[model samples]
Target: MSGPVTLPAILARRAAATPHAEALVIDGVRVDYRTLHERVQSAAARMVAAGVQHGEHVGVLMGNSVDWVVLFYAAASIGAVTVPVNTRFKLDELNYCLKQGDVRVLFYVDTFLNIDYTQLLRDVEPAFDAALPGEVLPLLRRAVIVGDVAGHDARAIPAGVERFDALPDTPEWRAEAAARAQRVSPEDILLIQYTSGTTSFPKGVLLRHRNMLMNAAASALRIGVQPDDRYFSVRPFFHVAGTTMSLLVALVTGACLLSVPSFDVANVLTMLDEERCTLTSGNDTIFLMMMGHPEFRRERIHLRGGWAAAGPEIMQKIHDVMGVKYMVGAYGQSEASPNVVLNDWRDPLELRVAGWAAPHPGLEIRTVSQETGEVQPANAPGEIQVRGWSVMKGYYNKPQETAKAFSDDGWLRTGDLGVIDADGRMRMLGRLKDVFRVGGENVAPAEVEETLFSHPAVQLAQVVGVPDARLGEVAAAFVVLRPGTQASSEELIAWCKSRCANFKVPRYLQLVLSFDEIGMTGSSKVQKNKLRDYAIREFGLA
Candidate 1:
C-alpha cells in the first residue's frame, strides 16, 4: 500500500509474499502465484515487443481461462488499458466494443460457434490480405490467437496476427516490462467494462486503478477478508464486481482466489467444500441455484462467509440455510465501480434495510423526489444520487450520456429510487424506470418481484408494467420456476398478495421457461429492459 498502488504492483507483492500458493484454478489447471506472475511478465513483454504502449487499449476476447487473466494482468503491467470483450457477444457486439474502446490489439481465443472472431475481424477489416507488413491496424492491429493455430493459414492471419505461443519468456523482457509497470500510477485507466443501458448500445464504464483499488480495499475491509481466507470466484472476471471486488481484492489482501470458467452449481458446491472457500459473491440467481441444488445441505459446504445481492426473503433464506457467518447484501452499478452501497455484516437488520454507501471517504448520498425534485426526508422514497471516488470517470466516449448522469453539482444520478432511513441506512425501493402507474397508484415492480421470489414455487421472477385500459398500467410477472416444480398464475398472485401490499401484487403472471434472451453483464444483475421488452412483445402490450 505504500507506493503507486496499481494492479500490477498488487500482483507483484502477492507473488513475492506467496509465490508457491495457488493463484488461479481453471479447468483442473492450478497456477501458482510464481507461475502466474511469470506468465504475466512474459505476456507483458510480448505485448511491448509487439508495439503496445502505455495508455493504449488491448482488447481481450477470450473465455474465462488462465489466458484471459494472464492477458489482463499483462496489459495492466504495461499501463495498457484492458478492455474485456464479452465472449458471449455476437459479431456486432464485438465490433462495437472494438470501435468504442478504440482497441488497437486483440487477444482472442479461436473461433467457436457461439462467437466467430474470424468472421468479426473480416467484417471490421475488409481488405485484410493486401495490407502492408508491419502496418498498424487502426481498428485492430495484432490478433493473437490463444489456442492452437495450425489450421489457420497465412492468408487468414491478416497483417499482424500472432499466436500466443510465439510470445517467448525472457528475463530481460520481463525486467523491462516490470520496470515499466512500476511507473504506472493508481489514477491510470485500468479497465473499460461494457454495461447494457436502456438503448441497444452498451456503455463502456471507465475505471481507473485508483478507483478500483479504493473500492476493493473498502469491500475487503467490509467483508473482513483475512490473508488466510480463500475466496471462490465463479463470477466472470470481465465484471467490475468479480474483477475488482472479488479477484483483485484477493490479490491485494494476500488471499487465495479459486476461479471457475463458469457457474456450474454442482461444481461450485464441490469447490466450496473441497477448497474450503470462505467467501463468495453473486446475484439472486446464483443463490437460488444453490438453495435449489439437490446436494445443498448445510453440512456439505464449509463456508465461513459470503455476499449476496437479492431480495430480503432470499437473503433470509440464505442466512437460515447456508450458515454463512457474514453475508453482505449490496447494491451498485458498473458506473460506480459497481459497489456503492452494501449491507454491513455487523447487523443482520442492515440486510433488511437499504444498502449503506461504501466507506468511500469522499462519497455523498442524497435522495430527491422523482416528481418534484425536492429532497426527501428519512424513510421517504426518492431517486438516489451519489458522488464519490468510486464513481467511474465516465461512460467511455459518450460525453453526452456521461453529462446526463450527473447534476450541475456533479452528483451522479443513480436512476434507482430508494429511501434513506433515519438511522442513515438507504433502502432501495426500485429503479425509477421500473416503477409504473397502475390505475394512478404508483407500483414499484421490485416490490412485487421480491415478494414473488419468496414463493416456494418461484425460483426467479421479474415484474414489468403492461398496459391495461382499465388500470392504465398493470403489473405483469415473468417467472422461472424451481426445477421440476410448477405453480399456477393464481397461486403466484395469491402468494404475492399474502406477502406484500395489494397494490404491489401482479395482475397477470406469465409462466415462462426463462426471463429474456438478453444476457447478464459481467455482474449477474437481471437485464430488466430485456424483460420489459419481452413482456411488451410476448404479452401483446406493445
Candidate 2:
C-alpha cells in the first residue's frame, strides 16, 4: 500500500477507506466512492471487450462530466494511456491531436454547445468507416459516444461508433478488467497530455503512473487537502493542472470534487456556497470574476485553502476582494507532473502571496544562466531547471525534441525564466522565449501585464510584443474592461506612462471584448502569437 503508488492501488485504497464517501457531485448527479470504483471497473472491462489492448492509447474528447472521469481512471487502471483532448477543438485540431497521439479508440460526447460531433467526424473524413480505422485518424478503430442518443432527438451513430449507455457491463467483463488491472505497473506509461502551445505546435508529454500519483500525493499534502474537503474543480481534465492537482488529488485524499464544466461566475459562486466547498483553484481571471459577482459579499463563502497562480497584483486583489486568504501560489508546466514549486499550507498570507512558491519535496530547482549554463545568483532571473521524481518520461515518440528537453546530467530545462529570492522561494519572471527587447532593454510582457492589472479600469490585461520600425519591437496592450466599465486606449496609455518606465510603457493599446478575440487555449493560457498578429494588422506596423 505504501510503495509504487499506481492508479488501481489508489482507487482500491480509497474505496476501502470510505466506500460511501461522496467522490463526485456535478449537475444533479452524485456518486460515492464505491459507485465510482464500480463504474471505472465496468468501463475498463467494456474497453477490453472492445479490443483495447494493454499499453494502447485511448483518447477522450468530452466536456467535464462523470463519464469523462470514469474513462480517465478506467484507461489508467487497465494500463492504457489516456489522451485528454479539448472538447472545444475543431475538426482540424482534433484530427491533428488524434493522429499525432496515435489514439486507437476515441470517446467523445455526441453533442456539446450546438455542435454535432458525429456529423463533424463524417465531414472531416468523408470515407470514415467505423468498422475499420478512421481514414483521417488512421489508428482509431472505435468511437464511443456518450449522450442522449436514443430518444426522438437522437441521431443515428455513425458506423463503428458505439453508444456507451448501450454497452454491456457484464460480470465476466468486470472480472476480466480486474485481472487486467492487476497487471498494470506503476512505471507504465498512462498519460499523453499535450501542452497548450502558445508560440509553437503542441507536443505530447509522456507521463507514467508514478509521475502523476506521487505528484498528486505530495501536492495534496502541501495544500492540506482533507478527506472531507470539497474541491471546486474548475480546470479541465485535459490539462495536467486539472487532473494531477484536482481529480487525482481527490482520489489520494478522499476529497470530493464539485465539478464545473465552464467558467460561469454566478453558477460557480452558487455551487461553491451550496456544496459548502472548502477549496477551489484557478488563475486570476476566474477569481476576478468571482469577486466581481454581485452575490460575492452576500454568499458568505466558507473556504479554507486552494490554488491561485496570478501574479502579485491580482493575488493581493483576490485576498482583499474575495476574502480568499488561505490560498497557495505555485509554478509548473505539464512536463513536470504540473508541479515544481508548491506552497506549504502553513505559510502566512503575506509569505504565500509574495513568494511564488517553495520547492516541493523530492524536487530540485535551480535558475541557470542561459548563455553560460552557470547558476544565477539569488534574485537574478534565469532559465528554471528541474530534476525530480515527478518529471515526465519524455515527449511521446519525438526523439529529437525529447533529446533537446533534458540536459546531459538529467535536469529538464523548464524554458521558464525565474528568480530565486533571498528566502529560497522561486518567483516566475516570464518565459525565456517570450521576452521582448524595447530600445535595448528586456521587457517581460508579464511585468507589463501585471502593471496593467493594477489599473482600476482594466479587468484583464495581456501584453504582446509588436514590430516597430526603429525600436525593433514595442509592447502592445490588450485590455478587457470589467462589466459595465469602459476605458479608452489613450487613457490606459497615459496611465501606463505614469506608472512604468518610458520603454516599459506599451506603445499601442486595443480593447478586446472577450478571450475568444484574444485566441485562448482550452487551458486558458493566452495565445500571444495570435495577439501579436492582431496587433500588427490593427496598427499597420509592417
Candidate 3:
C-alpha cells in the first residue's frame, strides 16, 4: 500500500496487465496500451535527444489529443516534470505560467483559432527569438509543434522550434525511449498545476508522482471505475478534475477515455449517445446543459456514473431523468488534490447531501465557528478545516498566501462553509468568502443563485451583494436566458420573492445577452469578483 507509485510505473503496469486494451479514442482513432507505451517511449527518447534533462519543467500547450498524452508520459519517463497550460488563457496569462514554471521546453499545437503562436512570440525576447528553428520558445529551450505548419517559414520559427511530426519514425527510437521511461521514480515531481486565480494571482501547485498516484487510487475507490468503463471527459485536462479523475483515474483503471477538447452542448450529446460513455463529471452547469438539451433521454446520457457539486433540485432532476446509479455530489478545492469529499451514488439520501469526505486514511476534518473560534457540534454550520496527505505542498512561490491558508497546527482552512451531520456527512452551505451581509443577515450567493436558476426562463444566474443605505447591503442578480427566451425584471424579482425570503430576493436585475466578461476558471466556476466589479462600475454602487 505504501510502495512507490509513479506515472511511468502506472503506465508500465497497465501495459503489462492489458497491453491490447484500448487506452484512448480521439476523433475515432483508437490507441491500444501497447502502442501508447511505444509512443510514450519514443516521445521521451526524442526529448532526451533534444537535451531535456532530469527535473526540467516542460510546458505542454496543446489541445486534447493523443499527442498530448504521449508528450506527458515522455516527460515523466525522463524524470522531467510537465506543466499543462490552460488553452483558454489569454497570451499574457499563458506567458506568466511558462515563466513561473521556468519551462525549458514547450510542446504546443500549431495553432488554434484566435490564438496565433507566431504573432504572440514576435516581440518575446532576443535570445528566445534568435534561437534556431527548434529553439524559438525563450524560456523554453526547445519547442515541438504537434500539427502541420506546412507553409510557415523556418527562419520565422523563432529559435529552437521543431515539428513533432518530423521526428525520426524509427523503431529503435521508440525502443530506446521506452527503456528510459522505465527508469523514472515515484518520488519525482510529475506535474505543476497552476491554481485558478479567482481571488488572487495564480500559483503553481506542485504535485509529485506519488501525490498523483495516491489521489488517483483514492478517486478510483470513490467512483468505482471498472476496466470496461468508458469515460467522457469534456473538462480540459489542465484542471485537477480532468487530470486526476478524468485522465489518470481512467488510465489507472484501464478504462477507455473519450476526451472532448472543449465543451459544446451539441458535440457532448452526440458523443454521449455515440460512445455510450459510462462515467462523466463536471461543474453543475454541464449537468444543467445536458438536462436541458432537446434530445436528452435518460437512457442515453445517464448510464453508470455522474458526479458534480450542485444544488438539491439539479440532483433530483439527474436522479429522475438519467437513472444514474451513482450520481455523486461532492466538494473540494484545488489544494486537496481536488477530491476531498464525495457522496456514494448507492444511497439516495447521501446523493442529496453535499458529499462525504473521502476515506483519507490519514486526513482529519473539523468545523469551527468563525466568530467564536470554537469547534461546532454535529449539525452546526461553521467553517470547514482539514489536514491530510492529500493537501498541496504549498502554493508555489507564495509563502505568505500559503501560511494564511493553513492554521498554526497545520489544518488547511478550506474557506468553505459547511455542517457535519451526526453521521459525519458534510453539507456545503456556501463559500465563507462569498457570503454577504444583507439586512444584517448573512446570505450565501449560491442559495440565491440556485433559486434563480430554478426559474423556468433562467439559464444562468449570479447574485452579488451591493451597498444599500437601509439594509446595509442588497442582492443584485445578473441573469442569462436560454436562446429565444425572455423574462422581464419584474417577473424575475417576483419569482425570487415567491421562492425565497424577501431580503434574499434580488432588488436589482440585469438581463444580459451573454456573460462574456465574466471570466471562468478552467473548471467552469464563475468568477464572482469580476461580476461584482462590473456591477460596481455599471451601477455606480459604492
TM-score of each: 0.93, 0.96, 0.92
**What TM-score does candidate 1 reach?**
0.93
The candidate that wins on TM-score is 2
| Residue ranges of candidate 3 with Cα displaced over 4 Å | 1-3, 126-128, 132-139, 150-156, 166-183, 353-359, 484-486
Residue pairs whose backbone atoms clash in candidate 1:
354-426, 354-427
Q: What's model 1's lDDT at 228?
A: 81
What is the C-alpha lDDT profile of model 2 across 230-299, one tens digit per residue? Answer: 9987898889888998898888999998887777788888898888888888887787777766677734
Instruction: List, residue by residue over 161-202, the lDDT tens digit for candidate 3.
Output: 677767675667566666666677776777888878888768
Residue 40, model 1: Cα distance from true site in angstroms? 1.3
- Model 3, residue 124: C-alpha shift (Å): 3.7
Tens-digit lDDT track of model 1 for 157-192: 755466777876577777789788988988899999
Q: All predictions: root-mean-square deviation over Cα?
A: 2.6, 1.8, 2.8
Q: Pull out the clashing pairs in model 3.
A: 131-159, 132-159, 133-161, 134-160, 134-161, 135-159, 135-160, 135-161, 136-159, 136-160
Question: lDDT for each of the candidates?
Answer: 0.78, 0.84, 0.76
- Candidate 1 residue spans exceeding 4 A from truth: 111-114, 127-137, 149-160, 349-359, 516-524
Q: At residue 105, what lDDT does model 1 achieve?
A: 81
Q: Clashing residue pairs in candidate 2, if any?
A: none
